[model samples]
Target: MTDHVDVLIVGAGLSGIGAAHHIQAALPERTYAILEARDAIGGTWDLFRYPGVRSDSDMHTLGYRFRPWTQAKAIADGPSILRYIRDTATEAGIDRHIRFGHRVVRAEWSSENARWTVEAVHDGKPVHLAASFLYVCSGYYRYDAGHTPHFPGIERFGGTLVHPQHWPADLDYTGKQVVVIGSGATAVTIVPAMADRAAHVTMLQRSPTYIASLPAEDPIANRLRRLVGVRRAYPITRWKNVALSTLIYQLSRRRPQVMKSMIRKGAVQQLPPGYDIDTHFTPRYQPWDQRLCVAPDGDLFTAIRNGRASVVTDHITEFSETGLRLESGAELEADIVITATGLRLLAFGGIQLTVDGRDITPPETMAYKGMMLSGVPNFAFTIGYTNASWTLKADLVSEYVVRLLRHLDTHGYDQCVPTNADPGLTEQPLLDFQAGYVLRSIDEFPKAGSRAPWRLGMSYAHDVLKLRYGRVDDGVLRCQRRPTRDAAIPAES
Candidate 1:
């Protein structure tokens, strides 16, 4: 017999926990359970254990709206974030509702029963469960493997090679030369962190990424907390961060040159005067074309200034026995090399979906409001903003889902599916970001329309208006109730 639930949430991470909280608060009567693939909570935070693993976005906005972050540091480390998540679950009694090691592999929807039959693996056995609605919080990338490009002669490298995604617990780099490949957030973070112990660290990149230095602690936030208290200051700080992030993003798009100059100037202020800013600090792409890499308290630049680390901008020709050899005839000798390449994006947790015996291909389908897929009934997924704090959008998605579920119950509807009504609407890529991870897997995900509702504006203000307060009975959504036995029988007439 299949165990049934009102809502079956896949993944017990940040988004999943938040979703559960909203459901419990808004629709307490509904029965729901979270299925986590891993044995622990904190999803990304728990998985990543590399040196200096900290959030790129500030905690004020990254933290859930319901629970305000009281920590002193706005940019928190992995352990702190993990503690925050676990504490929230424990306090809310949400820990009991999670089923660990249940990795959902397939989901089938039946129109007749108005339910989703989900199949997962647990302890090397198949487990079956049913739910009226399926909430996917599994996130956008695959956990099993990260995206690693094939480097010629990589097998010849004699030293330790590591990827930040799966950092080994027993690995040690103390008093050794370390070369971190790529200029993404992870690379920038690990360079400074590993520099503390490693004799020297070098960041090798083909092209540069926009790097910004933000204070670890916000003076304004601290002052506000002292005056108005943590609870009262949270919203104020969150709004301030959101507004600032939004303004910078908008300006980067509108006035690229001005923003580029400002970013360049900031980088120069942090580094030594003779440092090669053009070679190591400048990016060919416009600001925000790819997500900007943030260094708390300019740690990366400080390491460079102190001669503990340095940056080399050159393409890797091949990997020699010692380390990487560049196309410019320069070779970096290292005892350890770390690949901070990127992630492999996974849609719907790589779960197979079928509707009424028809296989649903994600790329062929359209994403409705960046949450639900067109023609997918009683289902919603969370994908956060690329330009701002992820939780800013995730919170809105959770609230919207709760509102939608309540609407269905109140109206006696068994199923509510968003159908793409406009056939003439042109399809656009759902994620507009040019990050390598996104670009590599964008085609595997669903498409969004070029117009409203179907198109995700990626703007928090616009989403607030459309998702939070938007009508549930909009014509684009088709709501239906299963026919009762008596109603199914033809009228006597």
Candidate 2:
């Protein structure tokens, strides 16, 4: 069956949900649909269920501005955040408009018709839908069959192997030796939580990572939240966390040695008496160089102090019958193994997009304000940087897209395409940071040349001002008139 809509939004996660809210609020008369690949609503939250899974940023900023975060502690866990997203979708009436089990595989833009033809699989059958505009909210390729890196002789290992992305609820870790591989946020979280229930937990990392610890609960903030509404308290709470986060980021950037010393001090306070912070906590790269791991309640550091957990700094040469054999000739035994090796991101629902039959190569395209891509008309994709909350930027982008759509509706135009004037522009990196996901996917993404709109800025303050209140005359967007034959052609008065 074929369906038609004014706008087709892909993915029902934070970004997609945000987009839907803005579009419906701004244009109540216009009809739109959010196509979700999965049966559930929360995208990443629904996908990752590993122990200690949670947001790295504070909830005040991570949550939507329209819906203030009411939680006392700014940092939140997976279940709470998931509930927030699901609740937001329900309250916004977004759930009624979604078509689940519909995995979009491709989208082709027709210049002749000035519409997008999207193809998806529903119930093992292909379905086509057309829309005047398309909005992509599918996050970076973080989910796809959880990544399980193969160590030599892994199949021969006697222990159970799992990836954090696909962690099982029934799997028991009580009194078992658990070894988690990878040093990102997921690994750091798993170590602490597992150490509580397991016989022992060991985190194996080839290199150290910059980890900062904080209390699980904030008392004064909680008091203020109770005294005032969350909306009233949200700004202060968000800024407070932002200020602290920013100060540490700047300290790490300017005074590397000082930041290193401070981090080591925290580690020393929470680790064993003779524990060497330099060997396990001192990262070779600058702090925030890669995303810094955050541990609330100081769980990771607590495990180390209590000697319930330990860190191994060496490459895995192979997997033995019951454990891993390190490249340094040391073998560590474990009853269970988890590969938190990270995620592989897919762009545009892993679908191949084309304009009038010509394929659009995402890596070769230019991202304008980190949202709109050159030559793509009335389309925007939400992608957040390693520094801030993913939802904050997504919410702002949603507002901007809605505004752009409103402008087009009033202007008697059916199309607003962002075409790079200089087709000969060479490709360059979007972000120069050392984030593992960004690093691995950089070569496969659209490059921002040295120019406005085309360049991607990681700063939230800059983007919020530019995107939320910026002008449309920027060289990137090209507003065009509707064709004479279209059904919505403006009346010639």
lDDT of 1 at 446: 97
Give per-residue CA lDDT, model 2, range 98-164, as digits (tens). Answer: 9998888889887667789999999999989999888888887856675566689999989889988
CA lDDT of every candidate: 0.91, 0.83
TM-score of 2: 0.95
Superposed by TM-score, candidate 1 places the C-alpha of residue 456 at a distance from the truth, in angstroms, of: 1.8
lDDT score of model 2?
0.83
Give me the candidate number with maximum lDDT: 1
Q: What TM-score fits each model?
A: 0.98, 0.95
* lDDT per residue (tens digit) for residues 41-73 in model 1: 989999999999999999999999999998789
lDDT of 1: 0.91
Ten residues in sequence with the least summed lDDT for candidate 2: 484-493
